[model samples]
Target: MSESKNIEVSGSVMDGMAEKGGVLESPTKKPPTEYTVYPIRWLVLFIFVLYSASNSMQWIQYSIIQDAVVKYYGVSSITVYWTSMIYMITYIPLIFPASWLLDKTGLRVTTIIGSFGTCAGAWLKVFSVPQDMFWLGFAGQTVVAISQVFILNVPPRLAAVWFGADQVSSACSIGVFGNQLGVALGFLLPPMLVRAQGTVDEIAADFRLMFYLVAGFTSVLFVFILLFFKAAPPSSPSAAADLGSSLDSNFLQSIKKLLTNRNYILLLISYGLNVGVFYALSTLLNQVVLTYYPGANEDAGRIGLVIVVAGMAGSVLCGLVLDKTHRFKETTLAVYVASVVGMLIFTFTLDCGVIGVVYLSSIILGFFMTGYLPVGFEFASEVTYPEPEGTTSGILNAVVQVFGIVLTLTYERMLESVGDRWSNVGLCILLAVGAAITAAIQPDLRRQAAQHKG
Candidate 1:
């Protein structure tokens, strides 16, 4: 039976009991009791983290394919841009809706549906395309993106509920670090696999290979979900205590509460712009490498691997710093500042010996680029109330994605009109703005948290 139908029937029975003069002791029909479940919740979060990690390969693999795609597909630079863009556009907007679905249906069903969609999308990429492969890849990515709506937004809320507030940021940071590691490995491995084949077709083979690999990997997580994942039983004390209070909160009120907080709004804008610049730069990095280092003549797979490896280190370092310090704003602002400086180096110092320039820029960019995830989500979590954390997070995720839409359009036009150099300069400016905004809101967010705690 459907979850909604089950809920309705349960409600009717409860009402009938009350009408017959029976005591309505519990909001849920079941008894209030604790469990011997120990710490299964952390295990569940880890599984979900792996699920998110597997999907990261789908997007991050683009960097590896950058040259192969340009060579085989004979397309413009914008082609790789949209491969990442398709997924971003497809997935980011769905965050709010995914959160709403989680509230209504629970994680099991939502995750299953997303997992299936992602798997199917991956399989479709096996065949060659008639038009721009962007649309075909996009169809698969759309599924992954839509699936991600559930995967990305729900986790931190789950972390908050299962692990409690003090551990929330740390748990989240670890999970996100897993996601980046997947991205790193995705970039690192594909080129080597292609090289072993001893032909360009062998390299081309990796695209189809990634689809099957990521799909099969992520599908395994679904089995774990089916076996171990469940709604908190009605008999659980937490469920019983929350039964009435859950009904009392409205969607509109939750939105109003989140928006009215000035600090939260500022953080959202900063994150959105930050993501916009990040995506734009990531998509363009391969082209930048080719332009500056003419002899490097490396495939997209190799270049992408280097960047992803650097990014992996950056993500872990960022998580460790935030977990230890609990200073969300300081961490984010510092990363943004570093990224701005890195973008400048990539643009202005292009003629300096390629190795010194590229290596320094990549290391700095990787270190600063991905660090935003840890602190950005941490900031969002602190601003939101515990109950509505999912919804609030969904909104923030969607807003950042909207900025991605702008970045997509602007990156393409700038790439064509002025050149890669100017396109990057614009990105540097956005990073600077993001840092400024994040820093500005730091004092306000600290004050609000103090007020809420007091």
Candidate 2:
């Protein structure tokens, strides 16, 4: 763990740091107590919510397209897996480069570029390009990945910069809540939006309509960004000056420092395992139900629907808890533990006759499963010192994306070969290990932060 560079400074104190004196030397000086809130700061927060909503809309489109994608583009059941897998694969590699851009270019430019890329991808999907369809689809996925990098990494840093510490956790929670809400909508709305026709292609036409909807909304966001996003305030210095250039340490050296840090390494591994379990269970749940019972596709889909709503509620509640408690590490560990319990219920109890018990268990699992999104980022943002918060958060995201990449590439095959039940059980065990690793690293991180503060 490293020392965070973000410090608490009032306007007068900041002015004193920027200039030589706390007092403004003007033609006619006002009272020292005279202060006004920066309206743009509020704009930043409002736009954050909108940005979140737009980003969430993108999620909605994917969930909408998933079944349609399978019916039309899907050649095999494995093809169905690619919708999540390839998207993650293409998206995972972008995080490192995207984070670098965030560090170098600042938020406004990178975010707008992300929004532009996302809209482009969405538009590509909106039209039917039959020849070389897979590659075109891959391109769309690539752009979406870039869009996600900006969405996930930029807004939190924005909140951290513009708001006080007391407000940051709340902002982070609200931002994540918006994302989950978007995801829930994405999952919930698509079935209705992609109106069924007699043929798969006909349904896919409706899916394209949904893609247009997402693209149009994101395009509006891009326009808003062009009008409002700022790399720096009119008065603020360059980010290079604010946070010194990373050029002094070569890439390998910087990476070595990051990897060698005990907490960072553990955090990466923990999150990776979490991603693996989350994806494995998420993708395999339907299959698991079908595997256990041939006629259970509808049941599994219903269960997944419940999970999404429960997960959204969990995210909101967890955010509120994080805001009040600030127990980032402990909360994360507890979530993983709960995830393990949920996995057990899924593994063992699905066959039992207790319908209410299974539903409650599934919802509980969903709740614990996504608890990491906000807390994990906050922990990485706060604990990684010497490096900019973006750097830490970026790499953390990269790690998760890498797991996502792994999930895309190998999980289906693993599930097919090992059988869903054992694979899920193994994933649950692995997630428990992730929780333990996170727990193991917590004391070291706290000790380091305390030492730095002292």
TM-score, predicted candidate 1 vs. hidden true structure: 0.78
What digit string (tens of lDDT, one per residue) describes model 2 on residues 148-228?
777666655665555443455666666666666655555556555664333765665666666677878878877988888
The whole-model C-alpha lDDT of candidate 1 against the native structure comes to 0.63
Residue pairs that clash (backbone atoms under 3 angstroms), model 2: 2-385, 3-385, 60-186
Q: Write the per-residue lDDT of candidate 1 for residues 16-118, one digit (tens) a residue.
A: 3456697867676664232112255566667767767766667745544566666656666566667677667876657666777876676677867766766
Off by over 4 Å in 1: 1-37, 60-64, 73-80, 128-136, 194-206, 229-248, 295-314, 442-454
Worst 10 residues of 2 by lDDT: 234-243
Q: What is the TM-score of each candidate against the true structure?
A: 0.78, 0.78
Candidates in order have lDDT scores of 0.63, 0.61
On lDDT, the leading prediction is 1
